[model samples]
Target: MSLSTKSPKTSPIKIMQNRIYELLKQGKRIDGRAPHEVRPVSISTSVIEKADGSAMVSMGGTKILTGIKVETGTPYSDRPNEGVFTVNAELLPLASASFEPGPPDERAVELARIVDRCIRESRAIDLEKLVITEGEKVYMLYIDIYVLDYDGNYFDPAVLSAVAALATCKIPRYEMRNGKLERVEGESMKTPIRTIPVSVMIGVIQDRLLVDPSPMEERALDTSVILGYDSDSNIVSIQKNTPGLLSLNMMEQIIELGSKKAEELRSILVEAVGLGS
Candidate 1:
């Protein structure tokens, strides 16, 4: 036998994936989880030694690492007194076979945009507070997300990871005296923030819609919808990229589901961040 030949006792992961897909067609899952039930999620914070703030979120077998870095800079001309926030996502090759090593691909860019928009456009951060000087000094927040593992439904996990990191993030203490800037080390405090936004995705396959779909379920779906909700369960943003039509009734149903689930997920984030409310 050739050295490259496989042994008789070989395991086939693809076969199992196909089997799971077939079972899903029969309205069942191999793990007995309901179609809408999300996998178990575990979250940890302050993992990166260098970043100002960091977090690691694991949803089932998927793992994502997020870091937040805050720097002082001049505010954008359009928003003189307001600070700026930017999000970047990197899906390393180690995370999954589909991802490659390079700059952010379209999927990663879309993911970052969705997460950034939900927070930035929702007026969650107190950008005015970030202004150390009127149109002179402002804070710039850079959020980086690295996917360490791949299971399924990476979008939700990535958002949660970003938020967790942000909640624990600390802004460097700076003071301007006589037009001179000074940085205070180990004396920084939490960044001023406002509302909390949560993102939830639903998959539409044929006539049925499912929440928290696995990788296989995602591949089988006609399209997917990502709904972002605020702490008050108000819809903030909606992004749909698939060529599928959604009825008003279906949209209503998804909104209700997404709102309810967002509240549930917010509780998890609150506990992770040790918030009073």
Candidate 2:
């Protein structure tokens, strides 16, 4: 007599995961984008008149607004000759159902830190040029980011908005008179920009990688990574989310893909801000 064997039944979740993987294998995503394709990006500068500089970035369904305020303050004790720079992010409750109205949770904090790292590590801003009186006084830049909509990949748009805002920032000139500093009316100078930093988010599912994953894609992803690169194609920052492990070969592939994407994003930023390449 021969024993009959039956295959184990596949769980619904597993079936769904398999479907996603299959689609990716065919070079297609649920949203009809290719594995390496990103969503359409739109950028608008000078959105907020009151702020020194401002920009709004929309990537697919995700929207982010960044505003910059410049003020004069004493330089840090250790870095007396350099100016101050701070980045803050807020995920409004209206942006997503998961967001709550209160102080920034871990997600918001992480978002701010990621953007800060990209700018700081890349040295995008010429901080020394912001110094007003060397160690005595210096320009303090406050970059505030707000999530107007949350679809999935907000990291790229947040960085784009912040960088665009900074690129268009106009700081009022100050002159020292009678042992006090006074702003020169009708006189302002553009923020000194050294380089532009662009960030790209990639999601890994099974053996395929997706660029600018949507909310559904994010939920199905095994892991995700964000890579920031300067205009010179040098990596400035890296952030990995989720617990999935990536092989050395996969990591190298990600870097190569990210560098090319970063260049494309940088060109968009430059054109949006009316800057020369």
Candidate 3:
């Protein structure tokens, strides 16, 4: 008999190798990244001429555009002293192969909810100030987010774009005269916003944690978490994906990394809004 018995067929070995990879905890990823490296981000604001406020943010292959349109309206009955704020998100089919053309899906709804919570709960915009009257008059802020491209990690970039768009947005000045409103034009004015909230996503694969993972990385991830941070670097909102459990130490590490990323992103938003010197 031959000393090497035909290597026992390479096909079975290949299958075993694949199973080992799936079961084992690899040391590092193929990209040679530490799993915490965020992709290069590019952001710009006031891109849409028709929108009162608009911004676009691109991270790797993911691209998001956000626009804010503010108008006068009546306040809600429950919150008589608060203005109205609404968020709508769209995943255009052009963005990715998976996105279909139609009304918003569950993904879109989730995106909108995350971004909306980050802003509303963070007190980024002063809603009480938006109320012009007890219940009759108030300002309505409508934020529209468009996913022009999808590579993964859509929540962070979308929220960032929304914040930048709202920061750069200029609402028309209206003066109330005898229960009538007149548009005031001359110089521009700022919206009634108090702070800015930034969002970042972290991907966990085995022992590695990746920040701003690409589509492939996202697909292979065991879990993904999103953390929304305010200008003060305070946690505004946290959304977790996947049922996989993480240790407290891992959570702390991710928090530190996310906070750093959020501050950097917030600076970008400030610059886009002309708030940064």
Q: Write the per-residue lDDT of candidate 2 for residues 111-217, one digit (tens) a residue.
A: 99999999999999999998988889899999999999888899999999999999999987887888899998999999888899999998888777889987667
Give me the overall lDDT of model 1. Answer: 0.79
State the C-alpha lDDT per candidate.
0.79, 0.88, 0.79
Error of 3 at 137 (Å): 0.9
Q: Evaluated with TM-score, which candidate comes out highest?
A: 2
lDDT of 1 by residue, 1-277 (tens): 1111122332334655476556667777766786667788888999987898899999887899999998888888888988888999987888877677988899889888888888876777888888888788888999999888877677888888988888889878888988888896668878776878878888775556677766655555567899888777778888885556666667777888888878878888888888655
| Ten contiguous residues minimizing lDDT sum, candidate 1 | 1-10
lDDT of 2 at 195: 90
Among residues 3 or more apart in sequence or in different chains, the pairs in candidate 2 whose N, CA or C atoms overlap within 3 Å are none
Task: Show the lowest summed lDDT stretch of 10 residues, model 3.
Answer: 1-10
The predictions' CA RMSDs to the true structure, in order, are: 5.1, 7.3, 8.0
- Order of all candidates by TM-score, from best down to worst? 2, 1, 3
Look at candidate 2 and tell me the lDDT of residue 119.
98
Clashes of each: 0, 0, 1
Ranking by lDDT: 2, 1, 3
